[model samples]
Target: MIKVLIVDDSALIRSLLKEIISKEPDMMVVGTAPDAYAARDMVNRFTPDVITLDIEMPKVDGITFLDKLMKARPTPVLMISTLTAKGADATLKCLELGAIDYIEKPKIGVTEGIEAYRQIILEKVRTAAVSKVARRTSTPATVKQQSIISGTEKIIAVGASTGGTEAIKAFLLALPANAPAVVITQHMPPGFTRSFAERLNNLCKVNVSEAKGGERLLPGYVYIAPGDIHLGIEKSGADYRTVLIDGDRVSGHKPSVDVLFQTVSKTAGKNAIGIIMTGMGKDGAAGLYDMRQSGAYTIAQDESSCVVFGMPGEAIKLGAAMTVCHLDNIAKTVFDYLNVTGSGSRL
Candidate 1:
């Protein structure tokens, strides 16, 4: 059985989390704590396989606790946060600090919301239990635009889930200022994507922003799919445009990687480059295969470098990936492909 520890400042939240987790047949809540101090004690006694940590607390915040925990024990952590701007920022920091993932507290109907998302919460806990936790690592040297052969017209499409934030950051930070246009779906909720995109924009050379429908795709820019919406690509005259759709969850997620990859295959065809990174499940597997069959270059993040290795592994199994590579090599590989093929140069 999967053992879990709940760390929160609220008795109510702790009880609610326990109730939700206890319903899972494969998992059990080993203990609960109302603060980080109590949580530290529980961690020693329970030795849980996973932890659900709340961001707000009376004394030590979740971020500090996570940093300490990763440095010491390296246990998989899933953060619980309020659906606010500060909460979003803190959650992103937690991810960078080696937390596995996060779930936002409902703003309106707390009970109903928790019940509605029970499955997702359980799935995250299961993924966290089996996740690979390691010390934080930095990206390699910055990308040089001049070194990349000019006139590569490639449009890159990427999809990720579980452990994607850090993976995507490393890939983008290594891109040149004139890198090809890129679009992504990272399986985040609304209100969080804007903060994520803004954070990426501040850190990376590429101009990254949350996608708003109808924007023309351009080089040197990366558009991230907004939460709770589906983002697609379409051919418009001599250029490509972003299409945002609000529909039922495809592959159990809004802004699914499958949706993005399918759209890219249909719209950009051989001009696109598809990449599936570290994530849980097979959301992008078949769509990536379509991209490969349509003559686009496809790559998967290799198993050793993946946090979960589910999505990319499925893609590799399905013959969707033309090549599988480490996270550090992905940027250079994409650039090398651009240098050689120049797929989108004439478009």
Candidate 2:
């Protein structure tokens, strides 16, 4: 059975979570904590396989508690947050600090909505139970930063889901402005991807935006696949362009990593670099395999740094990835492989 610890300050919320989780035959609420202090204590006692953490609580907030928990005893943590803008930002921060996933709390006067949220919460919990929990590692403070490539251009296609929001952010923030033309497919809702793209644009040095059909692929710009559509890269003579395909969902996702990777493999061929980041399910594995077979460099985030190793793990098992890297090192690894001075460079 999958064991869980529920941490929230609200008594009603805690009771509601308990009721929802208890209904699952293969999962159980092993413990409940009102605040971070109680949570820390319970961690030592129950040793749960996963945790459902609230972003807001008395004494210590969720983000702070998450950082502490990851530092002390890293485990899969699913954040429970409100649907407000502020809540979204906080929940995103939690993902950065190693939270596996998050679910928005139901709003007041939405009794039926709360029930729906309960189902989502349970599903997220079950998913988290099977995900990989990254352990905290200490790095030297004086580690030298690597230099960016002076002049090089290549196509970089990235796909992710579940814990991808923060994983992609962390990976992209390490990239230089002149890195490459990046096409990203992150599983997100309609309005959410736009907000996520805007957030990435603000956080990273590159120009990040939602991908539009037939747009010219340009360097220093990142195109995120819009929700409910498949993003593909099309070739035009010597230049490559973006193509958004509207079709049935592949592998249970619209903007599937498989679809994006397959298109990149066919269009860009050996000129592309495919990256599969942290996520649940096997959406990108087969496509990443195809990318590798087509001579495009493929990389998968290692199990040690993934919230859900399902995608990358599947790719690794299929021998699709040339190298498996930790989340913190994935960007550098990609840069190293694509650097103009390096042997793997196509430009």
Candidate 3:
């Protein structure tokens, strides 16, 4: 059975979480603690496989405790935080610090929302239990934009989930400001994606922003899909523009990777590149295959570089990925493919 420890400052949250988690047959609640000291002792005693951590703890903040825990124990952690802007920023930082995933606590109907989201919370914990937890690593300095042939004919359609925030950052960080127009759909909430895009814009040479739809896909610019909407592309004469599709969840996710890839397949055909990064489940496997069939080059992150290889692994098995490589080499590989195919000028 998967062992879990609940660390929260609120008794209501702790009790609610314990009740929800204990209902799962494959996982069990080992213990619950209201503070860092109590949590530290429980962690040593139980050595739980997964931890549900609350960010707004008193005395010792969740981030500081997380940093220490990751360094000393390296156990898989799932953060429970509010979904406000401040919470989004802290949760993103926690992901960078090696927390596998997070769940947003409700702002208004605390009991109702938490109870309603029990399945999702349990799923995150399950993903965390099986996920690989690594100690903190230093961030790479942003690479400067180098001049390359400028045009928007070629588009890059990227999709990721789970560990995607950092993977997308690494991929975009390595690209020059003059790289091809790129679009991404990461499985995240509305507020979080805006923050994620802003963070990338500050660090990378490329201009990154949340998609407003109808804007021309321009070279040196990146667009991120807003949460709760599907982001697709449409051909506008010789150029492509972003379009947001309002619909129910596809592939069990709003802003599904498959929706984006399918649009790229039909609109850009051989002129596009499809990248399926680290995420859980098969959200993008079939869509990646569709892109390949449409003559778009497709790539997947190799298992060694993926925190959870479910998505890419499924794609690899289905022959959707034309090339598989480590996360560190994806940008180089994309450039190499483009250069050989004469799609764009290289640096």
Candidate 4:
């Protein structure tokens, strides 16, 4: 059976979680805590397979508590967050600190909708239980300054979901502006992708923006796929550009990573590098396989460093990845690959 711990300040919330989880034959709520202090105690005693953590609490907030837990014990954690803008931001931070996934709190009179949340929670917990956990330490100076190649018109394609927001940040912040042009597909709600891109742009040296139709793929700039459409890469004579394809969902995601990776394989071919980060599904595995078959180098985040190892693990199992890397090493690995090949022109 999968053991779980629920850490929330609300008694009602805790009770509801227990009720929901108890219905599953293979899962059980082994412990409950009102705050991080109690959570630590439960961790020592219960040794749960999963933790459902709340963002707001007295004495210790969820983000701080999660950081401590990951540094110490490193179990999978799912966040319970309020459905406000502030809550979304805080939950994003939690994902960065290594929480596996999150469920939004149900609104008043919308309790029936919570069944979906319960299902998502249960599914994430089960998936998290079997995933590999990589040991994470502070970024080393050598990794921060690593470069791929001196002068290549390089392109990096990244795909992520679930716990990707923070994973992307951790990887990108370590990248230099001169690295390459980058295209990213992160599973997100509408309006949030732009905000996320803008936030990353401000924090990192490279330019980051939400992709628009026909935008040129320029060095030192990162284009994020819009939430509701598929973003593809196209080559026009000597220049590569973004193409937004508005269509039905592919693999249950609008901007599916498979679609993006397939496009990159066709357009950039051996000149590109594909990085599949942490996420909860198999969206990118087939496309990543295509990229590898086309001679583009590919890397998958290792199970230990992933929020959910589903996507990368699938890719690795399928022989799509050339290397399985930890989150802190991913940026440096990209640079190292590029440096050996010189750049796009050389390739």
Candidate 5:
């Protein structure tokens, strides 16, 4: 059974979360607390498998407490965050501080969407229970071995979920400033993708921003698919441009990785590089296989470096990846793949 603890200032939120978690046959709510102080006591007594931590509380905010918990005990934590710009930034901080994942906190007195909210909460809790927790740390800095890929026409399609916010950041940090055009699809909601792109832009050498369809794909820039719309690429005379596709959810998600990967296969063919990163579920497996079948070079993150290993593992099982790399060496792998001649190869 999975043991859970709920920490929040609001009595209602604590109660609601408990109600949702308690219904699961394999989960038990070990305790509930109104602040970090009480939560610390419960952590000692219950030693729960997962914690649902509220971002905003009366004292000792979520970020500070999360840092403390990671340093002291290192239990898996799932942040309960609002779907606001400030909340997005704070939630990312919690992830950096070692929280396994986050769930959107429901509005006060929420009624109409209670069922959906319960489902999401339980799913996140389940994920958190099995997640690995460790001290706050940065991805190892691996210097770029060379300058840049030879052509602006080469394309990269990256897909991730779960721990991807950091995985994507680590991968992007390795690419050269003038590397090939990259189109990314990460599982996020409507309000967070713009902020996530902005966050990556500030840290990496490459220009990163949310895709606003019709923008021409170019080297030195990375475009992230907007939260709800699937991102695709198509020819615009001689150059390629972003396209916001409207369709039913593919592989259990909007802005699905499968859509982006398959789209790249159809449009760029062998000129594309497909990367399946750390994530939950099998969203990108079939599409990644399609890319490999179409002669595009494909890579999957190795298990030791993955937060979940589900997505990349699926792709590997399907015989999709041409190369399997650790997260730190992915950019180096890309550099080795795209030699100076501009025709791709693998090391």
Candidate 6:
């Protein structure tokens, strides 16, 4: 059985979480704490398999506590955040600090909202329980000089989920500022995407920002699909532009990687490079295959480097990927492809 620890200042939220977790036959609530100090004590006593952390609390904020917890005793943590931009930013910070995943708290009808999202909450907990807990010690993606923009006219398409935040970060950080025009879809909620893009922009040499429809895709810039929207690319004269559409969930997610990949296959064709990274489903497999058929170079993150080898594994199994490499090497691989003329294999 999965043992869980709930750490929140709200007694109501704690009680509600306990109720939901207890109902799962394969899970049990080991303990609950109202603050970081109490949560630390409970950690020693219960040794839970998973933890649900609230972003705001008295005496200590969730981010600081999470930093300490990961350094002292790394464990899988699922953040409980409000559905506001601030909450979204903090949740992203927690993920960067080593939290496994997060669940957004509702702005209204707390009890009913929790009940409505019970299945998702439970599923996230289960995913977290099996997730890796490594302290990320990579230096920040800080560059002093303006990155030299390569004049190569190529389009880069990336998709990720679950542990994609860090994977995406690593990929983007390694990229030279003027590498290529990049479009990405990372599974996330609506309010969170903007903050995530902003965070990446501050760190990476590339100009990363949330995509707004109709912007011309340009080299050195990365367009991240906004939450609750599907992002696609279309040819405009000699250039391509970003497209955001509202639609039903495809492959069980909004801003799906499949949507972006399929569009890239049709629009950019041979000029595009598709990379599917760590995620939890087959959302991008067929699209990646379509890309390969269109003569675009396709790459998948290797199993050893994936936080969860689900999405990329699916793509490789479908023969969608022409090359498979570790996350650390993806940026270099893309550069290698751009540097070579044609008919090249994995780097």
TM for every model, in the order presented, reads: 0.95, 0.80, 0.94, 0.83, 0.95, 0.92
Error of 4 at 264 (Å): 1.3
Q: How many backbone clashes does candidate 4 have?
A: 6
Model 4 / residue 201 / CA error / Å:
2.8
Q: lDDT for every model?
A: 0.88, 0.82, 0.88, 0.83, 0.87, 0.87
Q: Tell how far residue 126 is off in model 4, in angstroms.
A: 1.1
lDDT of 6 by residue, 1-347 (tens): 99999999999889878988999999999999999999999998999999999999999989999999998889999999887888888899999999988887634354555555998898889888877764595754433223233443478999999899989998888877666789999999987999999999998889999999999888789999999999999888877899997999899989899999999999989989999998887899999999999999999999888877889999999999999997877877787777673333111
128 in model 5: Cα distance from truth in Å? 1.4
Where does the lowest 10-residue lDDT sum fall in candidate 2? Answer: 136-145
2 against 4, candidate with superior TM-score: 4
Model 4, 1-347: lDDT tens per residue? Answer: 99999999988888888888989999999999999999999999999999989899999999999999988899888888875657767876776666777776545346776877778778877877875443444643334434344333467999998778877888778877665789999988666677788788988888899999788787678899987899889988787889999988997788999999999999989888999998888999999999999989999999877867889989999999999998888988887776677533432
Error of 4 at 31 (Å): 3.4
Q: Write model 1 residue lDDT over 1-347, tens digit each, in one string.
A: 99999998888778878988998889999999998899998998989999999998888988999988888788999999887778889999999999999876634345555556787788889999888884587667776545444343468999999899999999999998888889999988888899999999999988999999898888888999998899989888888889998898888889889999999999888889999999999999999999999989999999898889999999999999999999999998988887777743653
Model 6 residue runs over 4 Å out of place are 106-116, 140-152, 342-347
Off by over 4 Å in 3: 106-116, 138-150, 343-347
Worst 10 residues of 6 by lDDT: 140-149
lDDT of 2 at 23: 86
Return the TM-score for candidate 4, rounded to 2 decimals.
Answer: 0.83
Worst 10 residues of 1 by lDDT: 144-153
Candidate 2 C-alpha RMSD relative to the actual structure: 4.1
For residue 316, what is the lDDT in candidate 1?
A: 95
Q: Report the C-alpha lDDT of model 3 over 1-347, residue by residue, as the tens digit.
A: 99999999998889888888999899899999999999999999999999999999999989999999998999999999888899999999999888898987645345555555987898788888887784445554444434346567789999999888888888998888788899999999978999889988998888999999999999889999998799999999878999999998999999999999999999999989999999988898999999999999999999888878889999999999999998888888887777767434432
Model 3 C-alpha lDDT versus the unseen true structure: 0.88
